[model samples]
Structures are given as structure tokens and as C-alpha cells.
Target: MENPPPKLQVKVTADASGSEKTVHSSGLSVRSLLKFSVSATLGGKDLTPEELGELLSNGDGLIRFKGEWVRVDARKVRDLMDRWTQAARMMSSLGIPLVQGLRMLVNGPSGQLVQIPEPDEDCVMEPGQNLRQTLDILAGKVPVSIPELPSRLDALMRPYQKEGFSFLYRITEQGFGACLADDMGLGKTLQAIAWLDTLRRKGRLEGLPALIVAPASLLSNWKEEAQRFAPELILRIMHPSSPDPWQPEKNLRRKDCHAVITTYGMAARTSALADLHFPAIILDEAQAIKNAGSARSRAIRSLHGERRIALSGTPVENNLNELWSLMEFLNPGLLGSRKSFESFTRSLERGYAPLRRLVRPFILRRMKTDPALVPDLPDKTEIPAYCSLTPEQAALYQTQIDMLHAVLDEPDPAARLMLILPILARLKQICNHPAQFQGTDDYAPERSGKFRRLQELCVSIAARQEKTILFTQFRSIIPHLHDLLSGVFGRSGLTLHGGTPIPERQNIVTAFQKESGPPFCILSLKAAGTGLTLTQASHVIHVDRWWNPAVENQATDRAYRIGQHRNVLVHRLICRGTIEDRIDAMLKDKRRMADDLFSGGPEQWLMNMSAEELNNLFFGSPC
Candidate 1:
């Protein structure tokens, strides 16, 4: 009779000879001393290494060992043994790093899924005192307390913000990099600043100043926030365009400099920024380095820092590759090389849960909707305000569609492809208003359906005397929106686009927050999507779809964050029976996918579509 299939198990123990060692020479740097042994089990007992050797030599698919009959596939047996043998050699000699140990703890030591009825149940780890204590601390079972905020920290931290500070402090204290991915407007900046202050108070940052890399637009915002919250922390802005043009190497050497802030572009181009070592390197809007192979990402990785912190509302903006990039920047080799990670991602047998489990320890994500944080925040209601297209808009949109068809029929594919984005932009512009597409000053309320809807909404907002913020991707449309909103509210509102000087952006934000400030503010979506808090406004309107849920959500959070006393109403305007409507439908599915995978979708997918598919997608009957 045929015997039952073999049962595989992994046993892990702490080896003292290799106890918590570090090897900086070759391969992955070693840290923990966890030894791994793989064996086959039958009924209740394990087969010894000698018995497994005997089984390997056996010709039959069945083997009798330890006084019990067991069946095994010769190939699986050899593969398992070969994998564990290599792991044993590494663990016994140099020891495994904490990341490798964690990976092994989640996945088997072979770094592959073991064919077992239950992998978690079959594997066991017997940790030594040090490993056990570290595991307990990471698991949060053993309380590790961080120091209370010193009086120098001017602002009162919310309960969750304090928890965020502790998490950053604790994770970095253990020599692991951290990703603080709290929801936008939940105070990720404040938490990072608090941790830096704690390090300063403890004399951990005595000589080595911390480095903060942010977007150019947010450099001023960071300066303001650091000054307001942690006034004692001496800071310097290191950019050529700063009021005091920073002489990179010279300014950084000043003894009073506790932290240096620079833009990602400046950081990549300036060699002096990369030359010095920093105690802590914090990246705000960390998604800037999502492309692992980009020059910016390479430059950021080249900088040496004892502790790394990546702060972003949306860490995984595009795909798992982006997540790998962030992880590689935070902790090199934590997820292996980029090529190997790509292989793992493509392998359906390996699964993604192991990857998630491997990184869960290092990333701290807190949503605004969490039960713990909900009480401290006010309510937010998202309302979809649908609009119809005018006859003029329909004609303009159809003209662009026809133009795209003409481009599609071109003999040269590259030339045809080059026109896709411009054509798509025109199509979106037509959906906004015919005046916007025509480049005319005429934006009559009746020329566009969206304008009519905007008029109605603004009239209601003005009647209630409530303020609203308008966000759009196109800078040219800001003037048009300002004119329309000003006429409705009977007062001139404010505008912030890419052209707004960096110094003035903060001044505009500050002015808008006051009780008697402008009743409305129109902003370019990209420039003000992040790093600004406008909780004073009770309403937020998305003038057009960026087609990216992560970005649109960040824009809406500008008002829905910590300080607002009243409930917020978010208006997402959709133009019916157009590209806007179709993308709006796809947006829901994209959001659902992002929620499941922590990734995002880009419009590049549209460029790959066939002309027929494009026509059907955009010009087809809209639901």
C-alpha cells in the first residue's frame, strides 16, 4: 500500500557560540544567533539527521525510521536538506541578522514556503534570554517606556501622537529603521520632531546633527513646525535658494546646528550633504524615493545615518516595488536585493503574506478612523457631487477623441504614443469646461455644467457663511476659479499654486486659518497635497479627478485633520458621461485594491491600451 505524504517541521534554537554576533565582512551583516534545523516527522516523533540521510539513499518513496513507517518524495527531501544545510552553515558561522531572523521566523529558514499542513504550527523557535527579551519588547508584551516629553516641547501631544513618538524612539533604539505612515494631518511631523527632541535631551545627538529631507514646498512648513513645537532644537535650512544661501559644508559645521533641512533635489546634487554622517535622517513625503533605481533614491541611500525615519501619509504609492524601495532605503538588505524581491513578487507559490509579516515590525501605520483615535477627531462626510456636460463640452471632448483616433492611425508608433498624454489632458480639460479647453477668458457660469454645480454649491456655502477649499491639478484654471468663487462669495479669495513662492505659501496658509480669513482658497493639487494643515475650512472640493485615490485623499485630509471643531463635507465632483465618469468608476476599484495591497495605480496604464479600447473606455456609454 502507498504510505502517507511526509510531514516537514523546522526547529530553531539560540546558539551561544554564534550568540548575537556581528560580521561586517561578507554577505548580510550578522546579528542574532538563531540556528535552524529541518526534519521530517511521522505521527508524533521527528526523524534524526542520520535517519534522513538513510531516507535520502533509499530507492523507494517510502521509508521506515524511528520505529515508524513514513513516506517521502526524494526530490523534496533533498531540496529541504540542501536549503537547511546552507542556512545552518550561515547561522552557525556568522549568525543571522535581525531582519533575516525575523524573515526566518515568519517564513522558514529556507526563505521558501514549506509544504506542510500548517507552517506556523509545525515550526518552533526556542529563543535564548536576549532574543526572548527582544522578541517580547517588539511584540509589545514587555513594556518599554520612552521618556516623557520635556517642557521644551511647547505643544501638547495627543495620546496617539505620543504613542507614535515612542514607537519611533523604540524602533530606532533597537537599531532598526522605521516608517511612520500615519494618515495625513494626523501629525507625523510632530511625532518625528518629538523623537528628535528626546534624542537631544538624552545627549544622543550631541555632535552629529540630524538631517531632514523634504519637498521644496514643505521646507518652509517644516521650519515653521519645528520652531513652533520644538523651539529649543537648533535648525538650519540648507538650500541654495534660502534667504541665507547655505554654503553646504560651511553652514553644516556650525556647532549650534542641531538639524539641517534640504530638498530632495538639492540633496542629490550637493555632495557636501552626502559627505557628513547624521545621527538621524528623516524623510518627509518619503514617497519621493519610491523608484529604487532613480538618482534621488541612490543619493539618499548613500548618506550615512545611525537612525532612519521615513515619514509619508502614503508610503506604498504605486506597487510592491515601491515598498521594497522604501524598505531598502530604511534598512539595506532587509528584503534582499531588488531583483530577488521582484522574483518573490512574481512567484505565486511564495505568497505576499510572508512579505507583509516580515515588514510589519518596522512600519507603524495609524489611520484616522482607528477606534483609539476616532474620539479625538471630528466626523467627515464624503459627498459625490455629479454634474452633466454642456453641449459645448460634449463637442470639445468629441473633437479630442477624434484627434486621438487620428494619432492612433499614424504609421509610426512612437510618434503616435507621444501624443497620448497631451490628448488625454485635452480630453480632461474639455470635461472641466469648454473655456478651459479653448484657452479663453470667458468662463460664463452657463458655459459648463461643472460651473453651474459650483455656483449652486458656493451659493449654499456662502449662505451658511462656511469656508471651503478648492483643489485642482491645472494651475491655469486657478484664476478662473478664483474669479467665479469671488463673485459668488462677494469677496476675493486666496490662491496657492506651484508659482507661489515657498516663503509666501506658509503665509497664505496662516492667513487662511484665521477666523476672519478668506471664505475660500483654491490650490494646485500637487503643490499643497501634503504638509499643510487647513482644518479651519469645513468643506473641501475636488474640482477635477487626479484619478489617484491616494493623492485625492491626502488633499481632503487637509481639512479633516486634528484641529477642526465642526464636521467636514468633502465634495468630489464628477462629470457624467465623460472620461471623468469612467475614471471615477475605476477609482473605486483602484481604492479597494490599494486598501488590500497598500499600493496605487498610475495613468501610464492608459498609454498601453489599444486605440479601440481607448475609444470604448472614454467615449463609450457612461454609467
Candidate 2:
């Protein structure tokens, strides 16, 4: 009798959309096709093309065909059985032993043994048997392969790794929330780019739809850093120049683009693009939305996305309430209520574990302690120096204090408010020296112990070929310090203040940090404290102190941040027998009070301190 002819077979499966069908040219083996079809039908809801492929390969379930539901059976396909029988014949004809071919038989496409129905010393084989059948039979014998896990890097990442970057990646992979709390000068931008790169490498990123909301000033910086670190990642700056700010469709559709960098201003006006459903959203200088009730914050909250990352150096700048707003953005309920956060902060201050539990899972903070990843650091030592007021400054300060007292004694509230401006002006002048306002030729006839010490310190740093940064609250006094330093160190002194245009400010900072240029840059504390980098200055002098410790730390980071190779020495010049000392003490006490209030406890200072205590700090006593 003649052997049966090979049967023609066809297999069909649903496409990703499930609305259309795809027919494979060579029909799938019974076992494999059943698994693929079943998985497709069951896991078909809202599945992406890639996800559907994975589901079909791993799933095991019954499939319905032509209104008949059939459970997957290993022996169902006749073609698979015939293929295995043919494989056994080919092995035998090749002069292979029966036991050897039986060992090689393994399993067929249906996951069944490749058994030779009949064996004879001389059995004629059919001409239709082919090598394709043999391969399909062998495939069923192998076990399902397991995939490898992602490799984890053990070495510490850069200390300034932006928390926003890490948080985005963690939330996407682990479905958790996170916050990026870093001091200024730490490369938060770079960390964000790194996370994007990781996603790209894993093929998890598609359409590269990422949005970076930053300050208008830092938009260029973001563009520059993205170019430097992630050159391949396309960046489109979303400004008003585009045809339609409201419609980001043009920028969003670009093949090469990965991220859209926009300012907080633009994001507020054009929130319609939020529907694009970005894979990741990063808010740089996140404090820009510290006010939860602001339109900007509301705009950001309106955005829809799976991942949200907030970057800010001053996480709790003015109050712990600021942290609540930030956390609410990152994860709706991670930090709980404002009341609960207050409680948590109280617990944290008392070294309680609850604070860690609440924050650790979502917050990853790296300070300067990690040795492997931290950048070259400069030493920051606070030096206390006293300065005697010039006769003119002394006279002016005394007059102003007396006037302030007289105004305060008045029953009129408006008069008291008016007195504040003049007192502020006098305090400003004192920070510089009365000569700054009085006259150029005027001098502090009374020698200042702090001035003498500062001079000595300046000379020593100059001699050692090191640079210095002198900070004062008053911009008016920058010129005086420039003059005084110039007389001592010649043209090697420069001054930077708010009046300095943005372009010129950056230029001056760059010049001061140069190895062969000016050895000192005197800056108005508020102007140059937060964003500028001045690593060449191995020495930092705070001629006047600010009430906020975070502000002070920001200024310190200019030198202590990345690229400093030498130890940094910081000097806080205070008039020893003056209100400066008392003010410094009061500021420290206030910081402690703020810390206590947030750490899940009551603020004792708020209750205990009367109007008298507040008034005395600003007026009554000299240090």
C-alpha cells in the first residue's frame, strides 16, 4: 500500500489589535499554535505588540477554533507525529544505531517521543520525508528557557545624582514613588539623563515622550547638559517660537526626539499637551511650585503620567509644608496628610524609625560621604572674625537704632511699619560699612578686629596662590570690598551682585574661578549664593550671615561642589560685641525651632517666645 500524502495545514492568530488576523505561511505545529492562540485570546485586552508576543510565548491554556474549544493535547497533530517518524528513518538511513537514534529522538513538536512505528533491517522510506520535519520534532524536546535578570551596578553613583532621575526609574520599574532632594550644584540634570539612557537601553522607552519642566534661566543649561551627556537622546526646547505652544504634536512626533524641555511658565499656559501621557515627567528646581495653591503647581498636578520626579535642593525651604506639596506631586499619598507629615518630622528629630519608613522607600539621598562616587570636595570650615565699626558706621548705626526705638514706642502701626525700611537700610549699610553710603573718602577710624583678621587671611591665601569668595548681604558694599581687596591684591579682585546682568554675572564667575585671573570675587550673598560655581576659591568669607542655614549651605556649595581639588576654608566674620552675634544665635535657635515643629512635635519656641523676645533680638541688646 502507498503511504498517505502529506496533509496541507494552515494556522491563524490575532494581531495586536485583535480586530485583524495573521496567517502564518507554514502552519504552526499543533502544540505551539494552540499555546500561541490561547494566550492571544485570553491576554488580548489592551496589550501592546511587544507585550502580546511575550504572553503568547509563555502562556499555557485552551484555545477555541471554529466554535469548538479544545484543550491542548500533545498528540493532536498528525503532521507532528509523521515528522518525528521521518526523523527516526533519516537517522537510521545515515547508518546510526537504533539505540543512538532513539536517544537522539528526544521529543517532537507536540512534546511527544519520536517513536519509529516499525523497525526492520531493510525498510524502504518514503520520498516525502524532509529535514524541516526533523527540526520541528527536535524543538519540542528542549525545555522553556529562562531569561537573565538585569545587571545591577555595585559601584556608587555620583553623589550629586539627581533624585528625580532615580525616582522616575524606580517608579516605572517597581511601581513606587520617589523624591530627589539635592543641594544646588549637584548635577540633577545629569542624573535625569542617566535614567533616560537606562530606559532606552532596556527598550522600555517608546516615543521617548519625556517632559522636563525647569526655570527659564536653567532651560539653556538643561539643553547643554543633555547634549553633553546624552547626545543621542533628542531634545526639543518647547518655547513660544514653535508654531503652536498649545499643540506639541509637531515636537512630540519627531523620530529622533526623546525629551521636551520647557519652562514652568510655558507648562502653565499650555497644559493641553498633558494628555500625551508622557512616560516620565521631571520638575527641576521644583521649589518653583513650593506654593501648593499656585497656578503653576496646579498646572503640574493636572499633567497625566505614570512617573513623576521633582528636583529641588531646598526640599523644605521655608517649612515642612513645602515637602508635603512636593511629595503630593511625586506620589499622591506617600507622605500622607500635612498633619501626618508634621508628626513624622517630629518623630524624625527624635531619631524615630517611622520617619525612615515613610521616606526611605521613596527618597534616595546621597550626601558627600559616599567615597566611591562623590566628587573632589573642598574643605568648608566656618571661621568667626570680629570687625570694629568705622566711626561713621558706628554713628550711623546708633542714630538709626534710636530712631527705630522712637518709632516702635509710638502707638501708630503705620509709623512702626515705615520705621522698618530705614532700619533695613542702616543694617544694609552696616553690612558694607557706612563709608559705602556716607562718602568714598570716609573711613572707619575705629579699627575693626574682624577687618584685620580678614586682611591677614586674604594675604595668606593670595600668597599660597589660592582664590577666595567674600560674601555680604548688601550689594552696595561689594564695591567697597572690591576697592579694599584691590588695594591689597591689585586687579585680582572682582565683585558680583544682582545689578550684574545675567551674561556678565556668569562671565565674572568664570573669570574668578580661573587659575591665573582674579584671586578674589566679592559677591552679594543673595545674588551669587545659589546657582554660580566658584571652585577655584579655596576660601569663602561670609562677611555677614543670613538667617536661613540652607542659604548659607548653598553658598558654601559653590566651592565645595564638584571640581574642587583642595580643602576649602569658610570664614563667617561677625562683630564680636555687636547685635550680629545675638542675631546669629537667634537664627540658629529659629532653625532648631523649625526642625522641632516638623518632627511630629509642638513648637515650644513659638509658644514661649513673646513679642518682647522677638523685639529684643532686633533692637534692645548689643552682642
Candidate 3:
């Protein structure tokens, strides 16, 4: 008869405070927080390590325990011992990450029911009581109860918004990071605030302050929103421009302070925030860290926080690579290292089912167009207004195109590559207006077809007394657009760009949002694209196309999001028979796959093209 096979039983025990300790030292392994051990049994008899060693030394196929003969394959027993030794060493050196531990519990080590079968061969792994409870929570086998809404919160949350808060609360309470990726105008900020306040009320914050990081432009917005919605929470802004005039580190540590807000740029530049750890950290417009290699991304990741929450409507604006960056920040090691993840994504089959399965539980996304979830959201109609170039604009555009062709013929490939982006920038300025390209103060609408089209649209919009918000990527053109729109609408409108003072942005927004306020508000796309509400405007006009769907969508959502009672008509002014027209067509063709992999605007893909391809794309006929 064959010798009885050796069976290994592995057990896991989780420390109650492991998550807290792990947050302080990101480099430490999960094994430091959890305990693991293995035991061997042969033919219903237990064999001690010494007895097994003796059997191995004797080169025997049988061992005795409790005066019973237990036959076993010595080689198999030795192999099991070797496997356990290696697992113990790894567990001691690089403990499993919290996310990785949770995943391993749900899906075995290799994502199967059996945990690493090749190594274990005939092993049984059992989760201890605490580990099993965590598994139950992760599997949604038991409901996570949320505390009642804090009475101090001034605003009543909509049903969907309340649900959003619950989702954030559940994941965060369990020490898992969350991504609240609701549609742009769906009040991600409000949901986040509600959750933060609830944490305070539930005593979950443990007397440690939470941290909020956002763009420089949105710092004031966060302060105002928190003050309006959760006034009971003592909030502080951590920037030199703050009126409090106190050192940020000292002010942030005040016992009365519940939370502190800072800009991404400041977080990267100042060492004051480097060593501080929070009970929680919230990243507004979290896509700011989409490039994992960026200094901002690295700095944000280095800050200590128990639970990380990211808020963004366009989380994966570009590709899966960006999604990896966001996930890495929220839950490190959940997707393995960057190189391994890149390899995994490359090997993914159609639909990327494995990666999707691994990440779906942590990210929550809702669309504004879902009537069942948001019945009050108004319709958004996008209309592309194609316009021809004026004679002067056409001459400048052609001249630049000829110069690009000449440059592309250079003997050095690197020299040819260096000139493409600047030429593209010049081409875009020419398409916007000849005066804008020529750097002149001429604001005549007849000088450029796009400006003429804008005048026509604004005239019609003004006749109906409907408000409009015009967006452009260029800050220099804001003054010109303001001057022209003032003439068309016969009223002094507002302008907010990068230069707009942090304190004045809210005032400018309030001015535009009033019933009898400005007829039009000209904004720089990058500065005011997000974290502002302009529902008062019924029309949104793009003075120049970004050739990036996510960015333009964000800009338009300023007027199209939740509180807007009127239908939003988005006007995208495209220069016909130019790079803008061709790129627009290419984006429309790629629209079907937008959710999975929409790349950045022309600035990115254009650089990778051959010189010949660039020539054709720049001067290509309208598709």
C-alpha cells in the first residue's frame, strides 16, 4: 500500500490593532500584524517537528505517534516543511499588505479556492475568528451599520447622496480606502463632508484630525462648503494665504480643529505636513495624482493616513495606467508593484475581467444620466458648431503648417520631434483667432471665424436673457473674450482664471450664480473646470476645443451638473478643415471605448506619431 500522504494545516490570526500599526510604517509586512503557523498530520496522527526530522534522518516511510504506526512519504513531508519555511520567511520579511490579505482571504493566494496548491499540495488553510469576521464584512455577508446623520449638518442629503455617504462610510470604517467617483455635479464634496462629520460623531476619528488635499483653486471652495454644511466641525485652511495668520502645523494640531485643508502644491512643497498622520485623508479631484511618477503623487502617497478617500468624476481620464496610480495611492500593494501591474495589464484578455474584479469593490461610480438614481437631473445636449477660418487666420494657419513641414524634414529626428508641440500650440492659437496668435490686442470678432461664431451664439443666448459660461484654455484670451462678450451681451460679465485670487473665486461664482448677475462668465478651463457650481447658466460655450473629451466634459458640467434646473446646451466650436476638425473626428470614432481607455489630448498621442503621420493629421481633410 502507498504510504499515507502528509497533510499540512495552516492557520491565520489577525491582531485587532494591526491596521493602525501598519498605517504608521508602510514598509512593514502584514505578517507583523497577523500570525501564521503550520502543523503536519499523517494518517490521523500528529507529528512533532523533531519526530518528523527523525523520520527524515532515518529515511523512513513511517512514523509512530501515540503508539500507532503512521505511514508517510518522507520526501513529501520534507517538501511540506520546506514550503512552510519559505512562507514563514516571506511573512516575516514583507508581511502581506492589508488589501492583499483581504484579497487572499476572498480569493486564495493565486485567486483560486485553494491557497497556492502547488506549494501546499495537501494543505488546509483556516482563518481565525477575527480574520473570518473581516472576510464576512468584505463579502457583504453582514450589513455594516452606519450612524445616524449628524444633526449639526445643515444640508439635507438627497437619497442618492445619502447612499453615497453610506458606501464611503462602510468601506472606510473597515480600514479600506475608497474612491467616491460620482458624476461631476452629483455632490461628491457634500457626500464626503457628511461622511467626515459622521466619523466625528461616531468617535471614529479618535481625536485625530482628518486632512483634505485639493487644487490651489479649490481650497477656498472646500472651506466654504465645509462651513456651509458642517459648521460644527472646526475646519482650518493650511496655506499662507489663509486669513487665520497662524502657523499651519500649530493650527492643525489644535484640539478644537476637526479637519484641515491644503493644496496639492503646498503638500508637496512644505515639510510641515510630511510627518503628520491623520485618521483619514480626502483627495478632491484625486486625478491630480494620475501620474504615479509625479512629485505630487509621491508626496501625497508619503503622508500618513489610516483611511484614504479619493473624489473625482474622471478618475481614469486617460488609460488603465492612470487607474493604477489612483488605486496605488488609495490601497498600496493591492495591485502589486507598478512593473508587475503593467505586465498584468498587458497580458489582460478582452474586457480586463481580472483587473476589474480586483478593483471594483473599492471604487463607487454613478452617472448623472441614470434617471432612476437622479430623476431631477436635466438633459444635456452637445452641439458641435463648425466654423471656417477667416482669411487672415487661414494665412497664419497655413504659414505655420508650412513651417512645421519644413522642420519635419530636418536631418536629426530629435530636432524634428522637439518642434512638434510648439507648432501645435501655435496652430491652436491661430485657430482660436489671428490676433491671439499674433499676440495683439485686436478683439474684432471678424478677425477669426470661431470668435465670430461665439458672438453669434452669445447674441442669441443674450436675446433670451439666458446666461452663458465661456471656457478657454488660454488665460491671455480671457480679457479679450470678456471685452467682446460685454459688447454682445451689453453687460459686464465675470472672468476667473489662474490669476483670480483664491478669496475672490467664490465671490465671482456667487456673482455669476445670481438671478440678475453677469450675462456671461469667461473662465480658463484648467483653473475653473472643476469644484464650482454655475447652474445659473443654461448655455456653455467652448471658445476652443481641448480635443480631450474628459476635460471638455468637466468644463461643461459646470453648468450641466445636478442643481441646474434648465437644460444645458453645450456649444463646441471646432475650426473646420484643420487639426481641430480631424482630431475631433478621431475622438468621436474612439468614443465607444472611452470608458476603458481614452488617452489624453493631442499633446500626448501627437508626440508619438511619425513625422509623416503628423503632417497628414495636421493638414488632413475633415473625416
Candidate 4:
């Protein structure tokens, strides 16, 4: 009576091409069962339409099909049943694009993607588009397309650069946004210009001018590159201080300019840009809008554009949110909203693979290490410039560590995390110099061993008359480092931090790049780490270590990028017998252990380390 104990197993399998969605139960395939069940109901025999529905509703149930009872669980069959119904609905209504429908079906109830098979004709992509080709593109398999750069491009593109241009070409043709995330100095700007030129050649630029937004520091670079590569295209730079910001608007209205270049800050601050429509909007160093809640991101969403492209080397420096933000800007709502993405990600134990699949088609990334991209790039060697803390620094560092230990002992684990963050901040500051934490602004070189080592290195560096980038994570230490570097290099140096005005950042970078310019450029890690092309600097010095090695590597890449022919040296300053040394080792271990699938930042994991581990990290000093 209870429908013989369910023993039947329902196996659902997608064919290799994903064209067929087959369900098999009791040795009967979906196609065969489709007819067998229908005939039984039509003949008024053992099963009815309602009986079939009832069978599907109960996980453990018996179904009488042609005199034999089949045992099965409805739980396993419901997903396919539901999908079958939905697919029929979609087919009868407006058909869905094969790629889009496949993407949706694969991301199941819990965001886990099922195997992809050949799509149904109703789900096939637009006429002439191949699903396999699209998959190849998403997976970054360059499928032997004749590599071509823009005919009008004044500069010669490398073979890999040409390949990059083609990827842009194909994606834009398919009506999708792109993220050209080539490593620092792999010619992303040039590739973009080439793509724009192709659009012009194809007459896609007739409706409206494309918009290019970058950091205020790179506005000049964009202008200069435009002038150099696409001389035929009229490019206008829109800025707040320009004598006539309206000129760009007038140009757009009359369609005079091929492209309008503006800074993210100006685009957010200037009301006029908010309403402007363009055929394409390209964001350079787009990580500037990595925070979804930032005004720049909101401003970007408001602008109307048919196509979006984001260029950044370090797209997701801290967490997956950064990648989500970049992808959202490039293709709004394609990955769902920020809240939806967060919820979906939190539901999975490790969502990196799913996250990659969801955004792969939209973002095309190439790294400099690919010999095909940068064959001639000189090798870079990173040396640990170890220093013993001056007695003053050592004393303050000890005191700070003791204070953090007290904070870590708080009753509330959450409260302890709150306390630990600031404590870590203070510890790093004390390592830099006692003066930084003491609020005395006394960054006397001799008071800190790291500072003393920096002086010794800079003296030798200055003798070579080569440029260097001095990077520190803390803004408060900039003045101190600048003063010391100025005396050592015997000339003024440029300093950049988060507080630096957007309009003036370009000027500082340009001044630092000139042959007669400052010998050193002091920059905070977060502000100047990613977008900068300070190839003039042959040496990169890390005044203090960030918790993440990728971040440190990004900062170093500001100098060790494509342009420099000279052998580059990277110096990471670490206090020999302190928390910095222990952390440096721990970071290396963690990176090796995680092998890049690691999602959370180092600080979060550090907080979870056992108290015994913490004691070992803080109490013992390694030289």
C-alpha cells in the first residue's frame, strides 16, 4: 500500500555535448519513459496524470508502469523534472541563448554547476556563434585566429599583444564586456586603443564617442598614448580644473571626438558626465572602484554604455569582492547584485571555482610571466634586507606586542579581533620608528635599524643615478622616509599616498619619470601600488611588509615591469628578530599550503592561529 519500499535509482546524465538531458530509471531512459507514461494515462490503465505527479512528489515511492512497479526517490528526480518543465516553458516562449541558458542551468540550487553538454537548438547561441568557440575564448585558448592589430596603430604590437587585441575583438563582437587584466606594463592601454580603432574601422563608433576613465594620475598617459597610437582619433581629456570641461560634452554632442578621457574622481564628482551616453566605456586601473559601495562605482553604474571594459593588473588584491566589483562594473547584473553574489558565495565551502566560471567569459587576463607575452623582460631577484631593530625600536616593539597579547585575551572573540587589528597596526608602526607611534614625528634614521639600512642602500643607489620607488604601507611614515631619501639621494623626491589630490597625481608621476626628475619616489602601497608605471625605477624598496605577499609583489611591479632593460633588484625590509620575521615565514608557509585557491586575506587567518602559535610568533626572534 505504501508503494513497495523505494529501491529504484534515478540517474541523470548530460551528454558530452550537453545537447541531451537524459534521465534513466529502472533501465528506462527519459525518452522512452516520456512515451510509456503518457500512453498509460491515455489508455486509462495503471497510471494517470495525477498519479505521475504524485510519484514525482514523494522521494520514496512506487510507480506502476506497464504492470511492473518501479522503486525511486523523487528527491533525485525533481531537479530534472523541474528543469524539464522550465525548458519547455522557455522554448515555447522567447528562446534563451544557449550560453546564457547553460550558465543558468549549471548553477543549480546551491550554485554548483553541473556538467555542460551540447545545447538544445532552442538554447543555441545567436546564428553563426559557436558554443565551443565561446568556451575556448572563456578558457583563454587562443584558437589560431590571425593576430591583427589596428591598421592605424602607430606602434608595433608584440605577437602576444596582437593575440590580446583579437580577444578584445571577439568579445566585443559577441556583445559582451571585457576585462583586459594583463600584468603591469604588458601594454593594456595600447591593446585598448587598437580595439577602439577596430571599432572605428567597422563604423561602430558612429553613434557616440567611447569613454575612457582612469586614475587622475594616468589621464596624461592615456592622452599621450591616444595621440601616439591613434592619431586619427580625436581624444578629449575631461577634468574638473580644465578651462573648459564643457568642450568634451560639446564634442560628444556633435560627435567630434572619438574618445573622451576622464578620471574616476572627476567622473563621480562631475554631474555632466553622469548623464552622458557612450558606445563603450573603458576603465583603466579599474580596481579604483573595487569597493561596490564607493561613489565611483555608483557613478559608473549610472552612465549609459553599450559596452564596458576594465583594465587592471591586480583586480582582486584582497578578496573576491574586489573581483565581483570589477565584473559588475564591466557587465552590470550579469553575476547578480552584490548582495546575491555574497550570499551565493557564502553558501559554498569554497566558491572560487564557481566564481571563476561565472566571470571567465567577461574577463580576459594575461600575465607577464608568460614568455610569449614578455620574452625580453629582464629577471627580477628579491633580496631580504634584514635589519636588527635599534634599541628604541626594539623596546617600543616589545611594549606593543605585550599590549596586543592583553587585547587578544579578551572574553569576546569578536572583540579580540577588533582589538587585534589596531594592535597589529601599532606593531608595524613601531617597527618603522618609535616616533611614528609616539606622535613625535621624529623619524631620526639612527633610531630605527630599518631606516639605517635604507640609508645605506640609498647611498649606493644614488651613486648609480638610477631611479627607485620607496614603498611603505603607512602614510605617516612617508614624511620621514622622504626626508631621509632627500638627504641621501641629494635631491627632492615625489611622495604619493591616499590623500594625494587626484588632479595632481599625474604631474607627480611625470615629474618622477623625467631623466632629470627626482631620484626616488615615495609612495604608500594601497594608493600607488597597482596603476603606476614607474619603470624608471630600477630599484624597489619595501619599507614595511604588508600582510599579503601578492600585495607586496604588486607594489614591486610598479618598477619591475616591462619597460626596464636593467636588472631589477627588489628589497623587502624585515626586522630580523621580530613579529615581522615570523610573519614573513608564516606567509610563505600559508601560500605554499593554500596553493592560490586560498580566498581570505592573511590577516583573517592570522587571527585564527592558536594562542600557542601566537606566543611562538611573538616571543621568539629569528635572525
Taking the tens digit of each residue's C-alpha lDDT, what string does model 2 give over 54-123? 4334333454433533333223223333553454445432332211222122210111124433221112
User: Residue-wise lDDT of candidate 3 within 1-623, one digit each (tens)?
Assistant: 96554433333332223344443222222233444455665544556777656655655555564465545566765666566556655666444445555444433123312232333434434455556565555445767777778664534788888878888877766667789999899999999999888877766565668989998778778878888898876677877788883355565556777888888998788776777778889999999999989998989888878778999998988777788789878877677667767776776656576676667768889998899988978888889898999999889998998887788776555666677778888989999988888889986889989988888888899999999998999999999988888999897999999988888888899898899888889999999998889999999999887767888889999999878999999988998898888877877776663433335666556545677776677766755
TM-score ranking from best to worst? 1, 3, 4, 2
lDDT of 1 by residue, 113-224 (tens): 2322223444454554565566566555677767889765534888788888888977777666889999888889999999988877787677868889998778878888
- Candidate 4 residue spans exceeding 4 A from truth: 1-83, 95-100, 108-155, 246-251, 270-274, 293-295, 337-340, 343-355, 499-504, 593-603, 610-613, 620-623
TM-score, per-candidate, Cα-based: 0.85, 0.62, 0.83, 0.78
Best by lDDT: 1
Best of the candidates, TM-score = 1
Candidate 2 global CA lDDT score: 0.56
Identify the superior model by TM-score, candidate 2 or candidate 3.
3
What is the C-alpha RMSD, rounded to one decimal, of candidate 1?
4.8
Looking at candidate 4, what is the lDDT of residue 27? 19
TM-score-superior candidate, 3 or 4: 3
Q: Compute the lDDT of residue 210 as modeled in candidate 1.
A: 89
Which residue runs does candidate 1 get wrong by more than 4 Å?
Answer: 1-101, 108-133, 151-155, 245-247, 349-351, 406-418, 588-604, 607-613
TM-score of 1: 0.85
> Order of all candidates by lDDT, from best down to worst?
1, 3, 4, 2
The TM-score obtained by model 2 is 0.62
Q: Local distance difference test, per candidate?
A: 0.76, 0.56, 0.76, 0.68
In candidate 2, the residue pairs with backbone N, CA or C atoms under 3 Å apart (3 or more residues apart, or in different chains) clash, namely 343-600, 345-599, 346-599, 346-600, 379-568, 386-450, 388-448, 390-444, 578-623
For model 3, the superposed segments whose C-alpha errors exceed 4 Å read 1-95, 102-132, 151-155, 204-206, 407-417, 593-598, 608-612
